[model samples]
Target: MHAHGGTRSGDAVPGDEELLARLRAAPVLAGPLPEFDPAAAPDSPGPLFAAWLTDALEAGVPEPQTMTLSTADADGEPSARVLILRGIDSADCAFVFASDARARKGRDLAANARAALTWYWPAHGRQIRMAGPVTALGEDAVRRDFLGRSEAARAAAFTGTVSEPLTGTQEYDRAFRAARALVAAEPDRVPDTHTVYRLRAREAEFFQGRADPFHTRVRYVREGRAWTRTLLWP
Candidate 1:
């Protein structure tokens, strides 16, 4: 079928059957991997995550701070988008991200208090998955987070509306210019809708892709203040 705007005669693309066959033929986890030992792993995956993050940075992986943030609506429909990881908190129990309160993600969080985040570094053949309950940070922290952002980022947050279709580029340009002027005139002005969210992970898993069919997965689950580690079959 043609696209909504109508397809051009020469604008051909692969059909669904061709794409399905290609997907079936492609190799999975065809990359080098490091060794993993559940026994040697720490009780909590937090510190190990920090080390892995450092390794990713050292390996020159672009956008190491970027992650796939996944959240489900009240009815259990899932949606995902890429966003920067704000920080790993002091206790290592949670990771944080910032958003506009009126954004779709914010609404998802409001309806469902749980979410998941995943980080993958193809060069290192590593992946981390985390899931747990989410909570909003205090006003003070939200203000600080918003202020610490770049001028453009701060101004965009000031726009407050996220995921809604814009009338046009010109409309956004006008909003951006106004925000920039307001910031220049009143440097401390912060929007009340700027928000930060913390996801306290109840489960964290680290996957090391192996050259062989059998990969290594080490999962950590929180129990009270402590954590339990287990090795899963690849």
Candidate 2:
């Protein structure tokens, strides 16, 4: 009752070729996707991105506000991680997020001062990419962002030294428990290492995947105070 290669009763695990074949056969964009018209897109990508985010939210996409943040070190080594989008600055189309200055990403940003953010809502068959120079918000903004976090989050942030190799869970748990108690006693306390950063996008791209071979890619570039929109071959 078992297949020769697939994972089943008395069957061996799939080999590399079998796995590759299965991957190629996987379904993608097999959905009743919404129509997108590049000509009707907003003058600026920020509004269009907001609209797509709303669409993904209404469509019940999980973690619609999550994005992959890509940063490069001083040596030009690139790294990426997924994190929540804290907020958006409407005035300058900047994407905001909070992190510890001691973290790897913070160090990378410190060296390069540039980063990229990418959001993909597979359920909605949409993607948004933005890249530009990143700058730290003022102390007031950093404090507000830290204080806005929940008690548990605040405690976690207090146990700083981010990106350090953990010696043991016991040590971390002890520090975290003490931090929690401190947070409970003084709710207004904020970590000095906590910072809020904004990436003022120089360019943004919106991609709409279609069931057919033709996909939609609309790119927007900023020139002075004006934005130029163009379609890319998909």
Candidate 3:
């Protein structure tokens, strides 16, 4: 019923009924939330997404560019991970992110080129979801992005063998130390496995939550080179 010193209030686990009650009692959309007028939204999802992202940044949402990247393996086993957005491609209007080509998610994309990205900024009561096929960028783009990263990031990227079971921290330390030294010696070095991917969304949805229970949802469906917008029932 009470939390001890040095323990967070959330650390106190409750019984099943109490847990459900606590969840129900928790406040949602208790915000000076931004207004979203679906009628005035942009013709394409890209402009609308850019506007929402800008709103999130201006509202001081932490890690506003962070998103959940979802992929499925060859057998349809789903996998999701949080990653920072690497800028969107303006020419093709695809969302960009990078990872080790040998990583589980990378292999998943290789086998099943389709994936989804979801962005949620609870502070603004907003969620955006995009799903479609993914494609790997050219080596030049991959190398440029890799070289632009911080030294520590480059060093970590150099430590390869992602998703493999580590024998111990000692092994990691050794590999990381070597990787760091390599990065120091060759600042422009990029791991062969470093890859950049773009996800071209076929369908995108924007959801805005309202405490009054009348939520707003707008979906954009790509048709040929144009996009069609639809207002959906909440």
lDDT winner, 1 or 3? 3
What is the C-alpha local distance difference test score of each model?
A: 0.85, 0.89, 0.89
lDDT of residue 183 for candidate 2: 99
How far off is model 3, as Cα RMSD? Answer: 2.9
Deviation of model 3 at 56, angstroms: 0.6
Candidate 3 lDDT tens digits, 1-234: 344546555565668999899889999888777788999988899988888888889989999979999999999999999988997853345899999989999999999999999999999999999999998999899988999999999999878499988999999899999999999999988888888999999999999998787889999999989999999998
Give the worst 10-residue stretch by lDDT in candidate 3: 1-10
Estimate, for each residue in 55-108, the C-alpha lDDT of model 2 and write its tens digit: 998999998878999999999999999988998875577999989888999999
State the lDDT at 150 in candidate 2. Answer: 87
Model 2 alpha-carbon drift over 4 Å, by segment: 1-14
TM-score of each: 0.88, 0.92, 0.92
